[model samples]
Target: MLSFRMLAPALIALALCGTGPASAQSFTDTQRGDIEVIVRNYLIAHPEVLEEAMNELSKRQAAAEAAKHEAAITQNADTIFNSPRGVTLGNKDGDVTFVEFFDYNCGYCKRAMTDMLDLMKSDPKLKVVLKEFPVLSQGSIEAAQVAVAARMQDASGKKYLDFHQKLLGGRGQADKARALAAAKDAGFDMARIEKDMASPEAKATIEENFKLAESMGMNGTPSYVIGKQVVVGAIGLDGLKEKISAARCGKATC
Candidate 1:
């Protein structure tokens, strides 16, 4: 916020004054007046720069504060999700639960899928709750509808996770047609899946997910609520493992 450009004149003035310490008795009235005039003119000419510098400083401070708040939010994920929609994975009676809010078109979500799969495979005491919070694009919404329909046909837990990973891991956009195709590839009956996707129950589930996401203040895809922590983005497998360990110990790692 302290503008180096605006400080150039002051620096030059200081350099010209030499390394000697200023003595009250050494300066003439005229010299004092000249210095004051220079400073006053410089400030007056750059009045707008002062405001700009202050605003920039304030923004940096605010961003730092927000980052701190986000870290704390990650540490306190217990109060984040009381109830969530979509299929769940891991032990039916696992000790720790990792809840995720994801969109089908989210690249980060796709990246996180590998970590989730690894966790499930390596840890038997871990549980995962997948919440469909498709807020990216219309294609994402259609994908969510198809995912909900898959859940209706008993495609919960691993199957749903599998389908989600497949759609996001690929290069194509996930629209209704593409989602249906993916559902079939994941072993779901395409016609039944499409019909179920349009049901009132599925619509209600998606609506609930939207409301929950809004209430939780989640703005983007691939946000997670693990134990008492909320992690946004794919923070990698080690990060997730640390959080899971903390959760097991009745604490949370941000």
Candidate 2:
């Protein structure tokens, strides 16, 4: 009486060693039926094995992806953290840098904005960079163009942040019109903003952001890079704080 777990490998080996098609193979129909029975009974008796195998597979995949992201992060360090195209939010000379690639129309990005703000307020020495990644719609692209133009109008990026908060926090869709309205409310030189929105520099900056995102394997909004980790989605305040703390020191809590 072989246990189901012990029979799994034998079943696999038998399948592999089969010489021909399903209609004409090494094992007889009776033998194949027995093998199937063993597998089916074993799975019915112990479903935990399936869950364990799936968990192991997930772990292996995550490890491989992490390794790949680490390599990409190293390869794109300059464009990721030090690019002039990115808008700075916190201390310029902070010891740790947190970078966010976001779309204005992305709901998750809007929610994650609060976490970013809270982190910046609590950590005076943390550097925050915002990369405009407008991938949602044409409206998103238009909003991003306005954002880039606003950043160009004032190199400090002070006005850009204000415009960002207003539009992302505002109701309804965030298109070129809404973004321009936010820009005006943020006290940007409206005339200059409109003028620079069409400038090649603005277009080039956005194109560079898209290229960087593509190289880093970022296909969605609100993706993040903190320390040596590439975090996707809105991981919340605690998650971000832990990564930032880990970057500053060696542990999740510093």
Off by over 4 Å in 1: 2-84, 250-254
Model 1 error, position 21 (Å): 40
Clashing pairs in 1: 74-229, 74-230, 76-228, 77-228, 77-229, 78-228
Q: Which structure among the candidates has the greatest lDDT? A: 2
**Local distance difference test, per candidate?**
0.75, 0.87
On TM-score, the candidate that comes out on top is 2
lDDT of 1 by residue, 1-254 (tens): 45545665664466347645556346677876676677667767878856885788799997775576456555444433334345778875788888788888888888888888899999898878788888989999999999998887774456766677778787877888888877877888788887888899888888877765665567887887666555667889998899898879855442
What are the C-alpha RMSDs, in order, of all predicted structures? 9.1, 4.8
